[model samples]
Target chain A: MSQQLAVGIDIGGTNTVFGIVDRRGNILYDGKMSTKAHGDITSFLNELKERLDVLIDKVGGKDNIRGIGVGAPNGNYYTGTIDYAPNLRWRGIIPLANLLQDYFDVPAVLTNDANAAAIGEMTYGAARGMKDFITITLGTGVGSGIVANGQLIYGHDGFAGELGHCIVIPGGRVHAGTGMRGSLESYASATGVMLTALEFMDSRPEQDSMLRHTPRELVDSKVIFEAAKQGDPLAIEVYEYTGMVLGAALANFVMFSSPEAIVLFGGLTKAGDMIMRPVRHHMEINLLPIFQNKVKLVFSELKESDAAILGASALAWEMKTDQKAETPQP
Target chain B: MSQQLAVGIDIGGTNTVFGIVDRRGNILYDGKMSTKAHGDITSFLNELKERLDVLIDKVGGKDNIRGIGVGAPNGNYYTGTIDYAPNLRWRGIIPLANLLQDYFDVPAVLTNDANAAAIGEMTYGAARGMKDFITITLGTGVGSGIVANGQLIYGHDGFAGELGHCIVIPGGRVHAGTGMRGSLESYASATGVMLTALEFMDSRPEQDSMLRHTPRELVDSKVIFEAAKQGDPLAIEVYEYTGMVLGAALANFVMFSSPEAIVLFGGLTKAGDMIMRPVRHHMEINLLPIFQNKVKLVFSELKESDAAILGASALAWEMKTDQKAETPQP
Candidate 1:
């Protein structure tokens, strides 16, 4: 018998990364496609199916492929639909999982990208042995996937883990898209860091900083992190403020679920101790005494490039287990 | 065969209520003892056992009793202990459950009062058929119990559902006991409502209301509720502000767990529509569009007097089921 494998696909706004992964979480083969190039869902699936077929053949044909798991924006696990993902061209609910299953003649599952990251962490990263923990992905927008009692919390609507949108500062910073003020996403995301940097620079007229030299449009989380590393006071302040907000929000998350650990993933974590110190400080300061020193805040151990694919593939393996449970053998 | 029964105990600061409950949740007989009357745990237990034996004899006796369940402040379910309950006379961790088991020679379990209420709601009240819901007890202090996927969330440490401590208004009201500022318990509890009314009165010296006539020390949640009934502007404003804070916290809770419903119990909820209207309105206003108007904020249907006993009895039933699972007969 051939070694069983699963296909993992991570659908992003700009690009989609897909890979054939073994049971041990190794990506045997990987591929990418331009997400924006295909205007419709059908075209996107056609391109994906065509590319995946070649990869499947290389890995000993379709029989060896156990299933396909997809991680997409606003993905709903229960319905297997992607609903109104702002970054994606798709306007409404798209049955991407069903489409993939039909095209490949294999079972397919889908979940939000953040949830996929959480599953990835559980399967092979920071949350490997933990039954209760939250995975926070601080990227273009903040996203979260909560795991409790060794199971991902899908909730009643299968959209339980939207921690980013939880308002950290009521009536404070207005979110660009949601228009909701003081949301964690509005203050802690990569975009949020840039916005905070811009605001800080604008407030201080006499302070000389590397960020001030760059054009407003060119300034991003990367530039701000670089400026902080070079000891720019304004850049340092930006991270401090961002971490404070993120920490307070994390404390709230801790109080809610009482997770054993909270794993931080994505771009913001790249700042290392610069961002982590304040987050740790404020989180402890805000937490109740019972929870104060109990929760471990750690970064994702999964390789960033492989995390999404691994997470999606973990979902595929999960489906195989579910199928086995449902069908008993004599 | 005699119908199996369980002894349910609700241990409060001033008084302790105990009853023999059947499988269908009916309290066959009930009695109370003054908790503060006894200075030591042994004395308290002796008195409680002496009184309870008479009640047990009225029924079918000890053979008919399946188990015992106790609900108290700061109760730890895993260890069956009550740790440093500020309101109670007990100084340190009291192994109340183990003590009961030793005394009665039957199985006994323990949990926090709020968790008991949640179990009660699930077993005999509003949350009877609901798999995902939160029970918020707004008494002297705020407390909560969360149920997800048809089980109470005890988290990694068996103390997961501590929603009262979650900060709603950062740096807002300071909790008298926890010393934590801006906690949900500080703003949404009955005591919080009294404090809010008192603060409002102090701020607006020019405003005339029925509360002005009542001595400052005399004002309580019941007094404020009576004043709100008469449509006093100051009293009414107090409920509105309390509701606003509660609503915002409820919105955050909804975002965190996405429970199907949030059941409100205890004294503060008795303000009825005066509190519920603003809570529902603000909860919707603060929630993201997807979660807006989806969560049901309902008052618990269990009789306030019977809820604690019923909840504890449910724990006894749960223990019985667990025992059966552990020891399967051939």
Candidate 2:
């Protein structure tokens, strides 16, 4: 059988999603499993290989598969390892690409999920035909991928483009994950919205709202979005604040690279105009006259998981045939 | 005579400097002229042409010259024009490259001064042999040039790498030039140092210092440096604060591109360890663990004007022979 499909894996904090995709961005087969269920990297690898084998057989066996690509938090493109990923059960460096390639008998590649999303955007999404753009993922954690001169800025360490970690507040909110003070991720992510919602409702006890009744643990970006839809002023303020910080950060990014557009992705983007209006307004006001009003700000058309899967899959197309047999072990 | 020399011009607000340079980076002949000595740009061009002709003749005529390269405020590499340079006598867009090429009958290239410094550093200074690094000029104003994958990131509008304008403090300080709040330039440039020194001394009226004795008009970064060297606590605090903000901004730039080193240029760097200590401290504290302590922060080895001249000259090497005749008029 001709090699016509690539396996794409998106490793998330809670769940691991994988798909077999063709060249045209079609997901021929896909499935999900608990990322932490197996506890150890070895057990997780065993289960992944077992599950993937069944999908491989269904898709006319291994010969029909082109290669594999994995997108994980803290993934390093140059080393093909996941280094010190905060959310992962396994600590330190894991040579995931080597393991996956050895198990599947095909070439494998890995990159931080945001970088994968950027490539996916360039190849199949909003950034198509554009040589310069940025993809910002606003989810549980903010992630970013910067593309300039038609290539991802992997930097010297393959860890460039961490816009989420860039300080926006300057000694303001403390980030729980990285212990970073006033990072864009700390203020603009879904978790940030929840934190903001809780603080706003708690501080303004007299400002009666539906969110005031919701348990603090149960309150998330979705609850805030729902209340916001119902014209909750406090909730609306949360989106505005989030967009303000995000917009300021976006302006900073704009000055750094002056990309043609900034593609926003993930959960918080669902807030839509509630977030974008302020983002656009702040970004414009902060920019120099030469850079004002030129960048296109758009939403990612691909579903969150699908975009990650497709983006990871896009990497496999670059694998050379000789890459399959050469392995760099951890 | 062989075409082994390039004419380099550094256009500044007060004075314009030009040099006839050999391929190995030696300035064979150099001269300076008052940029505003001529009221209009047309007169300035005529004077510049007449002066350059003498230098060209000294170097065996125009036939020996490879091309011309210019570094100026608001220079656009793509359009070869100076667009709305606030400091320059000429306003709006001036097609300097086209005019120079037409006069000298050779190709002419232009980029912002900071970018020229970057190319110069890469070719003949501290950044030599490094593929990825940033050159930051902290002069009367802050300017930057970013190099990644061995190419300057000009962005979509030929105006990328404006690290100076990136908001580091987020509404903390108002920039005089652009009126933007809390920009890196507002807090880190030489002008910023003067402002900080004044604020520091005024905020503590009881504190007796050398700066208090100097007239406010005469007090500048040099005065502050002298005061700082004398162990004046208030002046030292000003540098500490400047370094703190500059370091935080540097951390942001590091996270953006992950360059191997950040080369510091211009007047403020002359303060040496007085500023570098706090900059390194604040930058390390602000960065995530993965990025901490990896980037080398060093001062530019080239003299201020020479670096700009050499950097502008470097652009001439890239001009294709055929590029000389095809002029794009502004």
Candidate 3:
């Protein structure tokens, strides 16, 4: 038989990436489309289909493709819909999985991006062989996927793991759009880092720093990280503050779930020990005696470019395995 | 086939209650012994065995018993040991389950009291047929058991659920013995309620109230609850503050796991809407829009007297089923 493969699709606001991946997590063929270029859901689906068809053909054919899996914003595993994802231009819930399955004539599954990352970590990355762990994605906003008892927790509404929104500071930083204050997302996300940098600049107007040279609009997480690397005191303080908030939140999460490890994923982890050192310290200091020195804090092992695709594809493999378990021999 | 029964034991600092329970969760016979009177682990075990033997005999015989399950302070499910339970006179790890099994010639399991309560809630209380829910015990201290995906979450270390120690207020309400600050237990437990009442009194000495009639030493959770019921403003404010702190913590817990409901058990729930109204309000206010209306906050339906016995018994039933699954049938 031809090598079995699954199609992995990572849907983002800017671009949509699809790849043909082998069972071992190798992306054999890859394709991409501008998500914004498609004015409507129909056009987006058509473009995705055309790209996937070409990739499938290159990978031996659609017959060799076992199924398709998607990771999208606000994706629901139970209903297979993207429910009111704010970043997406789509007006309402989109039955993206069913649409993909209809086009490809194969089983399809979908979950939110963080859940996909968690599955990726569990199946082929840092969390391999671990029964309980949390994969925290620190990106444009904070998101989390919780794994307990070797199963990804999709609570009653398939939206169980939204650890980002857990209030960290209790009326501290307020998100402009969501009105959520003191959330871990408000302090730990890349946006949070940028906001912290801006607050520092405002608080200490007399202090000379490299961040002041850059325009307010241009100063982002990258600029702050670069400044901190060059030993800029203000930027260094931003990381310290960010990591302090993050570490405290992580300590609470450790107490809540007692995961073997909390794997950090996405952009903010790029700060490495600059952020991790303080996080580790605060987490240790804040933990209960029984929980202290037990939970591991580590970074995700998945390659950044491949992680999203791999995570999405892992869902397809899981679905294929579940189907086999349910079927009976003649 | 003869009816299957199991022994359920709740080991507290003052008393150790053991019961013979049928498969359907009925307590056929019950007995209790003064735990403090035993003075040592060996004597405690001897006394426990003697009492349990009498109860087991009344329930039919040893042949009718499937196994034993014990719930106690600091009980470790994986090791079947009570590790460093400060309230107990035992100085070190006590292999309670193994000791019981050796004397009874049957399998034995042990877990923390809160975990047992969670299993009981799942099996025979408000959480029946529900796959995801949290049982929060608000007695002298706050305790929790988190159930996800139809399985009790025993994390990598077999201590997954400890929501009580999750810090709600940073550098606040330090526990005298543990030195743990800002923990949910420090604010939401019966002790926390008493402390809050004391703080209110200290801060507002000029305010006329019913609480003043009771001496400062006499103030406790029960006294405060009764005073609140009588419409004392200061006492009423104490419950509001306690509920606010608790509700905020509960909101965070809801965000962490996104359980279908949070079942409150033990003394504080006795305050009813006086406490529940503020808790519900604060919990709703603090939650994200997506999480706000979806999760339920309900009081546990299990009877206080039977809950521990039922919970421990549920563990035995679970073990019996697990054993059946492992054994090969003839």
Best by TM-score: 3
Cα lDDT tens digits, model 1, B1-330, are 353898899999999999999988899999999999887899999999999999988986788888887889888777788888888887998988878877776678888888888888888889988878999999888889988777777778767788888887888889998898899889898889999999999899999999998998999988999999999989999999999999988888888878899999999888899999999999999888888878888999988888888988888876753442113111
Worst 10 residues of 2 chain A by lDDT: A321-330
Residues A1-330 of candidate 3 have per-residue lDDT tens digits of: 353888889999999888988877888988888998876899999888887888888877877878788899999887888899888898798988777778887778889999999999998899998989999999998989999888898887788898998988876889876797888999999999999999999989999899999999999999999999999999999999999999999999988878999999989999898999999999999987888898889999999999989999988877844442113111
Which ranges of candidate 3 are over 4 A from the true structure?
A: A1-3, A320-330, B1-3, B320-330
TM-scores, all models, native as reference: 0.95, 0.94, 0.96
> lDDT by residue for model 2 over B1-330, one digit each (tens)?
588999899998999999998887898898899997776789998999999899999988899988898999899988898998888888788988888877778789998999999988888788887878999998888999999877788898889988899988876778877899899998899889999888888888898888888999999999999999999888899999999999999999999999989999999998999999999999999998899979999999887767767888988876776664234221
DockQ of 3: 0.77
Recovered native contacts, candidate 1: 0.61
Question: lDDT tens string, model 3, B213-252?
Answer: 8998999999999999999999899889988999999898
Q: Model 2, which residues run further than 4 Å from truth?
A: A1-4, A53-66, A318-330, B1-3, B58-64, B319-330
Q: Backbone clashes per model, in order?
A: 0, 0, 0
lDDT of 3: 0.87
Q: Could you list the CA RMSD of all candidates, in the order they appear?
A: 3.3, 2.7, 3.1
- In order of DockQ, best first, we have 2, 3, 1
